[model samples]
Target chain A: MRSDAVLNEAVRGPSGPRKHRMLPSWVATTALLLPTYAWLTLAVLLPLLTMFVFSFMSATPMGKAPITFTLKHYRAFIDQPYLLNIGWTSLVIGFWTTLLCAIFGFLAAVALARATVGRMRETLLILILLPFWTNGLVRVFSWTMVLRENGFLDNVLHMVSADTGSISFLYTRYAIVLGLVHGYLPYMILTCYIALVTIDDAIIEAAASLGARWWTILFRILIPMAAPGLISGAVLTFVPVIGSFMEPRILGGKVGVTMGTVIEDQFTQAFNWPLGAALSFTLLAVVLAIFATFSGVLRRGAAA
Target chain B: MNNITRRNTLQLMSAGLIAGAGYSMFPRKAAAAGTITVLNWQGYGTDEAWSIKAFQESTGIEVVHDYYSSEAEMLTKLRTNPGAYDLVVLNAARCAQAMAEDLIAPIDYSKVPNISSVAENLRANENFNKDGKGYAVPWVWGLTALAMREGLPKADSYAVLGDPAYKNRVALQDDAVGVIAAAALLTGQDMNNPKDLDLVKETLKGFKPNVKLLWSTEDQWNKSFAAKEFDVAMYWSGGSVRSKRVSKLPVDFVVPKEGGIGWVDGLGIPASAPNAEGAHAFANWMIDPKFYVEWATKAGAPASSNVAAMEALPADDLSRQIHKPEYIATMSIMSALPDDRREAFNNLWQEVKAFYAE
Candidate 1:
């Protein structure tokens, strides 16, 4: 309460502080903040705070947490190398997902915007978004069925092998990439779509009338124009995908470990909240850094 | 939040805790009783509606249950302005923490009339009840057993998973405990002895090279396997049994002659539970023989702790899902161990994985 008054005074000026005069306003206007603050506090702040507190506290003898405060958990998190490896894996997953999403999204957006068709254009665009209607879990589950050993892909391989000689597929890092691409590929497409949809068809037609080759226009104007959306979509997809536990948990099988799994295990099974929190925050920091970097890149790309 | 900000908040909590009676501020139960909210990790308790539905129908309590994928999430909700949940179900080790932190209240058994009906061994189980008096009640317990395609069956054990012939055809449960334990058992390291990092590593190295994939859930994994995904894998003993029955596959499970890890989950009342009476009613209702029997009949994991509950189960399922009482007594249950030991296993397990994943 006192801090609130002080903040108000700092903004409004001390002269009319008591009167609450027409001085300055809040950093975020109240109407704007009501929803935003609630969202952040509930979804982000409180969870992060709890993770931080649990990090300081000792894990119960069962390797979880006790209310008792201790630094032993932080020490444990720092000391372990296996958990550290998970951080590296998380980065790899995030980077690759973003890169892939950017490529596929860019190409799809190009086709959607420039390709001339009446009903077909709208229909093709709608088809691209059809996967979004399904829940994320459903999409991931579908992939598991398709890729599991002796699953559709594996059976296909086996069928081919029966005719030829050998076969295998499923639950490899390759399986994980297939899942990641499936999961975030839509975000990329959506982002790139926004950029492409905004462009006037005349600009491309005008460039084409000047006798520019199709590939030349895509490389020069269309790509530069849509680069912002492509990067923005990559940012959206990559930032969270970096910390994703599910795609890997379900598809990576035993072969995958990302920081998300490590942080999760620390809190749930390991009972070392501090270490989990520390690890979580470590992952959080990495995500934020990338998020910031991407935001910077997109801003500059928009300008460029 | 930034590190400094997080540190300040934790410092405040720690200072506040020390200044008061060292327990967390358990939210007082509500007076007039609105909805009794229950939060649980996903896939816990009886399958979908099993844990809460019975309580709602029988007691006329309007219960709202939310599922979380992690305990940190549940703890986050409780720690920051708790008053949302009336009761929570957590493992025994967590019950001790919650109780000490004052995040949970000791279960007043007198209020829960049906508690004594819980099986005798579980009543005094180390994780659920710190004292003989109840604070948390055991929900479901089973050993970490391996399941395999039964068509090529001989007497089965963990060693079958390591057989080079089965390499890339076998799957293991993709969890730290199951992975480490399976590896340790094959290596002849004590499952209970979480220390012996080197042996665990060596054992997991042997097992990992043979393992095809690790699984996190029964739903997709089983469907894939039923459709001939991975030939065999480590599975929840109960689920594996159910899967075999439903798939009508030649799938069989071994308690593992070398040994297996046993796990148990308990339901506890959070200190901040909004409806103590309702929560008690719910907990009591959850453990009933009738309830346990339904879960066992449909779910395959029999609640053997309750003799009456066991009686309610089909005679054949009792023979199959849970072994005989004498065998149950000898069965080793998975316990929460200290970090150094657990991490030691995690480190070794990761090494083995890196080798195999390579």
Candidate 2:
């Protein structure tokens, strides 16, 4: 708080020769922020407020039907017992996806930071980010080609063995996890890379000089420094994965009823907007709680 | 000061040309009486570029189109924007709902002479006719049924989908209404409003061992089939046609002894249609034998409701071969569902899907 106050004073400039001709700093800041606030109010806040109102309604305000305010939609988890299972399934999927991404991504980031430098490091970083250039739906669909029965993987397996049955694991929860990890791994890598790259090489050399083995150095030194990045990456990944419908719907086949798909069904298939809004708010609350839990780590990561 | 140089002259000329081009590209405002707006699914019959051009050439009225992705969206568009749409395409199941909401007006069958050629069953379908007043003109119709791999024994019933012999080799549609309707038919109950939903649920649950995929889109179904995902699946008649004829997948559509789940789409004018006369004229043209033939042969469309239009197709046409008139009698046409029943179906389907995941 003291540092923040000092920074604010520094930004406002040394108050010693206040120019009467110039507008106040607060006015300038407000003027600069007004357009952004207006845009947010128009685009995000208004729609969210509308949906909040809708969530409390008994029915969608359509045709000539009179709408009444009701809280039945919020009782969805209790009223519909099956939703609890679906919500749990979504969390499980999110947990696995986030775990896999952190494992593979952190290792990749460490490799990029320590093993490569100059042009090679630049090239590796670009390669890591290449997935973001393509459409996410296209990437998920392509995984089907690689993972389906008698697909690229099975064919390769058949090439090695004369008589091998198909070993495809497509249309399963594993496939859903694989698709999500592939989609989110780049985010984990980028975050960890940013955090890891900032570490002074002298610190690592000093640990080596102290006769610490590679694993010890990694565990005691690098991991501690990179904890913020890992937390931020996990939060980023878990939040979206829980809400993702496309990866599960495409890869999971019959077993893809997540909270995302359930909410989508209310809006698109069932036309139960009130229920959809209620579910969305419930999901938002869950997401906000997650953010609150990780707020400290996220702030520290930003500071780093 | 008029100091006109060669560069300035050239710039002015190019600017004038660009302005002229932009002006020409902008759609001219036609007299309200001469223009009619239609609301339907994108790339459906109404918005076909060739057909719309032909329609404009034949009739003085111009055709513009707005699209809705879902039935609820169509109703919402109608409710919110009065006089915005002259005509809308509604499934027979949704016609009653639209009429109940007073979103659509009663059709004057006399104005649509070609509607006479529409198949008697479709023309007299109770979903479009209420209180002896026709709300919509039956346009095109199809069924949701089984599509099986070629060389497999022809499926004679929906029971074949639950056969454990094809374990992990059967696909089901990922829709509540269609899936429940199929299950209802399997359990010997009314597809629209089944009395024994428990039996229907049990029947669907029994298929879990054989259920490999619950496909939502035709493209996904085709890709999965091509990758040898499933041999037998619940698929659309129109999709089966496109699969065999266009995609060249080895699949045959079979309407079982119990019957396929039938759906009919009709053209209805909005209650507040600004140009009701033009809407009627366009509606008549849509059902016309000539227009139906062109659309079916060239663009690939659902079977026409007009018997004469069906007859106009060549003897060997796949659409004609598959969409048999006799099937209409055995089929169970979908009807408008009450909100509670609709919610129940959605909940049941979600539960069954969750069970599948388990």
Candidate 3:
């Protein structure tokens, strides 16, 4: 009878008499979460709130300019039609980069999952992640050595065919795509690898036994199983590629003016913080819209 | 303005820190004195180890430095951190803005004796002198001009940048103001406030066939040149000097017949300076002939504004040869541009770049 009473007390928390004496569960939870919430408020939310305010200002609140609120900055796209073209260019670049990463990354992850195992898989995983160790600027700069005229690619080509003309494509969109792919490919691989590793080996074996061809098993089974990873990787790659300036600036050369560079110019060169903030908010809005459109798929993927 | 690239600035900051730590081991009499902080571009003359060491030993005033990568950043630092900086380096084009904001104090010329030797025209330039009060001491000046490979024929005009013969072999600096100014010069208009911006845009767009690279940094320009990326580029006079003297790149700098876009940097005392006396002493030393010669010979530098400092250079210095005093008369010195005009220039340049991409 005494043990039963103890079990009852454990299930119902403290006995009724002592209930008021103990701290509330919500209070304890709030205490636990307070640090993280406080940190987020200070670091992320506060700056974002400040930028949001600045975006509506007539100009940067510097010097002796009398500050006034305005929506002219948000009307930038309507005022300057060229921004639409630049926005489209950024999207196109993002699309290509994401598609390329998905294809290459999915294949690499499949190879790691099926073709390799044990120590070999571990070593390959490390090798795949080695690029992250080097600086992004260094990686972008190294591409010039490989892609420029009379560079490594040209030198190797000349060795193969003495009369071969220069095939250097540095300062081109292709070069920008290549550098970006090199920089962000690891993200796609790691995410896909996580999704692919959890699939049962029996599923593939059963498909094979049921007269499924290699392509059939691959497309019908493997891809569906890896959809979550593919979506996640595409999101990761596309978001950053659209906002990237360094790759375009270094590799695309004269063709490098994107929304990213324009926004950068407003803050650093033009000293127009309001315009930059407005552009940034517009970009953020587009990003949010994308997430909203894909929310259903993302939710299903997360649940799976 | 001598704006170092962000990458170079970080490297310079670390290098400065290491040097600063090394200097502390051999503390001089100034070690115990009050510290006076200077605001400037990292690796600029103010933070040079040898000069800082010498200045400290002689004056018995500890000098520390803070750095900014861009003129905008420099202004932000001055505005946000009152009394944190005793001295700051301001571009002549920006001196008016700083003065209007009261970020800088009126420089007492009597305290800076070296001002007497500075070029009369630069000293009296309305950019630094506003309402008959000097705000900045003219420190160094340079111009943006054509830098061509050694074997190429000398380019006497900015039109060479668009010449069809040099198709896909021309590089342009990636600064909106500098590029627009060059185009304005080509179109026979005032560079600072061009009345015919559309004409200037057309002129810039015409160079699309020739522009292979739009280089932003000295390092990038050098590497691209070394890689045989382009034959000619719109490069800085100081950059050309360093390319030839330090990196040993085979390049020739020319002002062209239309003249280059000129810019002057000045040293100014901030309005909230705690060590105004120390700042004056440092400014005097900065423009001193002895210091200029050492800095020029050992380290590549922009042309000094001080006439005596320029004359004190060895007969064959690259900077002296490139930055001729007569060029100052022909060149259009950049002045304080209104915020709207600056934005317009940036937008025009962006539109022109998009056109080039097409």
Candidate 4:
């Protein structure tokens, strides 16, 4: 047939060039695309697959990697009451920290967006955002030095105590939360500012003429409009804060061990990488669930 | 000097030629032999005094050193794909566990005659050479003791943490061994008995009321203690010496009359190593009394295997160190207990963590 003649001609061509002609453009394009996909596959996907595989594995006697796969690690987590308790503890910390960051961030952003002439606002804004300019570890270290009883705050406290009798403020849960909020507050503020700066002043004026009180207008219109920003800010703040390793580590000391430290120990010094991976996966799953729920609600709210 | 001249010439050539030809043939006398890598703790090296610089100078066999922070971390490395490393430095307690699993090889002391100079007290330590044969050289030893801030109520023992005067001002090592040892010491129970897990749990809970902080990292220890965040800190001898070096305040290192953690970390070659000759040469050089004392002075970690070396240390405050021979005699060498005991430790550790986390 004519097809056989064409195949014969293709085969008859020099073998090196003929091989290239056999493949389609899409196939070549796919081959060209493969290195990038391969890089991601080797670097990210393979490890994630290993994590998924080992969540079903067990810790060996020598405290090395899992030699056999079983659901024991996951089952171990489910059966343990303390694990459930830790999960709840993480949720509580995440929810409260997010709430505080969102509230403070929204107010601060609005104040920054609306307040004073150009340079003053710029200077004040820089001062507000300066802490974020440092690495998170350094910032947390700065807080540790600041909040300790022997630190700068304590020096002030000692000056006060010299007048009074004494005071103690370190190693409380208050310090840990305070550290996390300060660390993550800037992101929340940025998110809120991006949302707030675009709103027309006329919206407020319209609400005012419609006989709505300022609080009512804020509650009914402003807050609802800013809801997306608030939600995004919550996600931004809570995700890192909840999974924090260093902040709670340095600041929390004895008074801390959120899900973050648990996961960290499982990997670094514990030699239980698989277990650590599982713990991280657990944290990630929770984060993803929150994101999904937030997005779902946002889509519905936007449609409304 | 001739080899050095050739090496300089090789350096000037193209990088590829240096890698391929000139350098390998030039070191015909010594560099013909390959390298020996030592995996040890950070403080084990001798840059200031207790460093490997002298050994390298004496032997001419290139020595490379790397460090790990914890015994568990070191064990993990040794167990899973021990890279080109020929030797590891580890505490005998951990070594017992590692050797039982055959992760490391027994050291032939005849190959390291300098090991014969290790103190008799150290030689007799059952933890290091339980079967009367040596697979390791006693490189260094130290204790975990309590260091307290000045002008605080006299903390003669760890039990003082429970004293109402020190409430909300106590720090404990966040490690399982330190935690358990402190518990055993405070409870007036037999320290070596390996009692029921619940008993250990109850004893540790008492210390919980006063201990506001638990430190796991060396940096955390240095910063927290220096800041005087706690009135009393349970600390290792190594960190205490370093803190004492730069501290403006008068810090007191105390080995409680009750007892403390005494440990001996030894240098041993892994069985899988091909360069046993290099390992032996390095081990012999390390156990020299002069070398041992040298590192202790510079690194601020006093050595346990060398009494003569300790006596030889010229640091004026060496006398102030809590490493009294009599006190060290009272200290029991820590050993890795059975698998069940480790599990018991973890279980109790979780309980302690839960109490504090809440």
Candidate 5:
């Protein structure tokens, strides 16, 4: 409270160091944060609680079936060994998608922050974000037109050389990862750009004046400064990528069954809501664990 | 004059944001009265077919169309939100389940005299009728058949889907019932209750090498087919006809020699419908021979039950494609599955999908 008053004095000018004339600090803080906390409670916390309760049920309480509490839903992975494999597939997709997005997005952010300026940089940022405006399903479907056999990519390859064989990569894991990266690249870029743009150019110039090479300045200054953006972007990408079934279903085809798709089947096709809820909680645990592990770096980055 | 300070830019942005939010916050008008909402499948709505516009113009009741992708989705929506929808188009297998759950009310035949134009065989079908009581009125019926590019070898058998020659060139339906039934039919087992679970598993496993994709929604399959992603697929009978006709593609749909899975999608009123009168009127108007003729001709769905509609169809290539005898004879209709067996099939499908052929 003392620090906040000092900060307020700094902002309001020292000439009129006005006496604290507001409500108690705690009351003011609660009043300011009430709406946000209420929104989170209603939207996120309530649904999560409902899902946890449903996870313990024997059957969906719909139709003629009587609902009973059971642990069998949690034992789904053990009951069906294939779920383990699907979980592993989801992990693999999450890993590759995050890695690729970080690399591509960080480089794009660097170029936008350092190499471009003004209108050009603004236009490029808009272009990067344009995909997010369109429906994700439609964008994923469009990838099929480019990657399928005799598709646009194949035709382009053939045009370069008549003897080129089919280069169709659709219905493959590689295509799934590619589509995911395309879908999430803008987010990573945006976060990284925000971090990078705030970086002081004088710091790099000072390093160069001290006989530091381009690589040294980049490794020592740019990357460390941008770490927060990269980490946050990766967390955002990895969490959703693990929960995505549509991209894998459309692009990966027969090979696309992952933990996300399995959970979806339980609710939509199998009508096994309890099992789906259990699987969802398991995924949530994994996501929370990831965030927990990175909490330190995230806190430091956020402060930066 | 052009020195725009950070504070000035922030003020401008805030002003723009306020205008945008204020515009959206304005109160919108309520829905007009006498409006009846119908929830149906994607392509079945009047916006796609345009024939249903005639009914709306003739009757004063306004028709609002919504769409549900699957039977489970339809059931969930109807169960959770009573009185939300006046009419719904549900599959035969689901119609029986819906009636038992009291999600839908039994049809009052007196209110819909167009039932007379529908064939007796269709009205008495097990899906919509229980103890001589009709629930949903059957509208469109089709077989899940094999659709291959015209020049490809005639895929008259399900075995062709697993043939090494067509490896990485075939797509199957992604649903548990459709894939399991197809596997059962191929193995010469009863589709509804196959005694040989191991053989069914083996049949689906054997198909892994040939299967390139498993498409779930009609939109998924149609887009993939239009892009020529696969040479052959387990095609939705009505969807295949529509796509082939629209694209002028030389794709032929034939009932596989192993027989085909069949389904009948029709209209029914929700038990808690707010506008039951409007719902019945809309249902009867849609099934009338006069409107069904246009639906059959324009929608590219077979009007098997509407006798007059069938006769009115042009005796042309399009009509022949729409109406096929084998769609009925070899058709294995889907029935409600016992819970344990349903779970078994779902698990088996997951295993089959995860299977990798060496």
Candidate 6:
């Protein structure tokens, strides 16, 4: 009976005999959070949901045509039979670009962390990251000026030998990979540098005191410790390079068909939005699978 | 005190986010009194010629301009944001598609009497009108012709594009339908619809080895061509002519013996136009002989749609090159493709692009 009196007092306020009660703390917290979460729901989540719905549609939602749901958009790869080839081409580009960036970036990070000190290291870091500040489309277009036939590269060669044939390497797979590596190398370097900088110098000194050579110290201690950073950088680079269309279009030219370009065609040229949405979901699935496969390393890196 | 500060900060952040989202959801527009908004390509305004400014001064309608790079981009904008634009410049082939989608409204010819002043060949062309009603006015036209570097043998046939001698020295337009249509022209088949997919595929494959680069943007075209990246390309008429005149290169534009594709850009009013009357006024003003003359002279393309306007311009090299009525007659005009045919051609083009080098 006393507990019932207390419940009545809590519901109707401590001093008043009225029946209205104050809202619970949890409800107040939710109310405070609603506007922010609602913004997110309206901006990002709603568009994703709309795209997911459109993927199952028969055509773009234009004109007075009847709307139907079908899986034919998803099955486009099977029907055309050549989309598989494009997918494989994209995979190949991603593999090469990632491998090159990993090798180049890890070395640059090592040099910055160990070799340089004070203002020298800071300047070098700025130099490495300078490209990231410029616009990517402009950077990609400029490479054409440097790599096209009778361009900067060929002119340099001409100075060395008067009768040399033009060593034009633009519009090839090599040029595409070169442009992509230039664009993404800074990302890998920044990631690996964060991991490398935290390594205690004492650990390296102790290994050297124990009769370990530079190669031994690097292979055994440095690499294994920076594995998480390397893995995360690779994941970031690989994901974007696989879905890249502009770099391949500018540099790879006629041989530049990839899943990204195909999806772009659906939206821009063919006016096939349903097929584009389905292909995007397929790409998203691939991205998710890659992250799931590497979540452990990412978690470790974050913790570090 | 700490708890109160934290709660205040959270509330402020939430308020800021809500405000931002609301602002983005309904973007603020300038006051709309006497404003005539036009959606068009980049070069058609007073920036390219003085006539547009002259028109605005005469009409007292404030001109607001928005630009798009491609027809598809224009279509998407029209679909998403209705009633925001008064006029849109679209390809002649897209008139039917726009009508069927109810994206544009029928034009009143009585208001735009300048329509009668255009050359009879271009006025009320089937592509711009339907069942005696007009929806679009022909503005500019050009051809996709063969372009080769100076001192090369004259390329009179479409077969020259596929020749192995120019291997690794050829560029094609990075367009799906245009590429396949050109290939169809090479085989002497129906340029609009090729019944035999396999035959077209085989024909395109033969040309693939020689085509080392495929360019899409005008910048890419200019930079690469200036650098001597390729010996020959499927070049746009106006750009190729400018390249020859400016750089004095042996850049030659030729109408291949097989045929070439002709494209016409036209101005139309959207169905949901807020200022349809102003749009008609602008359309009428655009096709006026004096304005056409100024546009053709400044923009460096012929005003074939307005015969009186073409005659007004001096008989110069650029005018003579683009104003050839006989050449225009030989050109195969583009038309809206049926859905089934469009799909088939798109698929075939994808196959050609994805072809792996052996």
Q: What DockQ does each candidate score versus the true complex, computed on alpha carbons?
A: 0.18, 0.39, 0.45, 0.27, 0.24, 0.30
- Cα-based lDDT at residue B191, candidate 6: 74
Could you tell me the TM-score of candidate 2? 0.83
TM-scores vs. true structure, each candidate: 0.66, 0.83, 0.83, 0.77, 0.77, 0.77
- Here the TM-score of candidate 6's chain B is 0.73
Ranking by lDDT: 3, 2, 5, 6, 4, 1
**By TM-score, how accurate is candidate 1?**
0.66
Q: Which candidate ranks first by DockQ, i.e. highest?
A: 3
lDDT of 3 by residue, A34-86 (tens): 99999999999999999999999988997667889999999989988888888
lDDT of 6 by residue, A66-96 (tens): 7899998889878988887788778888999
Q: In candidate 4, what are the lDDT values of residues A88-129, reduced to their tens digit? A: 777777888888898899999878776655898789888998
Query: Which of 4 and 6 is the better model by lDDT?
Result: 6
In model 6, the runs with Cα more than 4 Å from the true position are A1-44, A62-64, A290-304, B1-90, B97-125, B128-139, B245-249, B265-290, B299-302, B356-358
Count of backbone clashes, every candidate in sequence: 14, 0, 0, 11, 1, 0
Candidate 5 A-chain TM-score: 0.92
Q: Alpha-carbon error at B76 in model 3, in Å?
A: 8.7
**Retained native contacts per candidate, as fractions?**
0.39, 0.78, 0.76, 0.56, 0.56, 0.73
What's the lDDT for residue A254 in model 1?
A: 69
RMSD of 5: 11.5
Please list the residue runs of candidate 1 whose C-alpha ends up more than 4 Å from where it truly belongs after superposition: A1-78, A117-122, A154-168, A200-206, A287-299, B1-141, B153-157, B184-190, B263-318, B321-326, B335-356
Off by over 4 Å in 5: A1-16, A293-304, B1-91, B94-140, B265-295, B298-300, B306-312, B317-319, B356-358
TM per candidate, chain B = 0.71, 0.84, 0.85, 0.73, 0.71, 0.73
Cα lDDT tens digits, model 4, B118-230, are: 66666666665646666677777677878788676556777786777778788887776567877786666655455665777776777777888988866677788777678
TM-score of chain A of 3: 0.88
Error of 3 at B282 (Å): 7.6
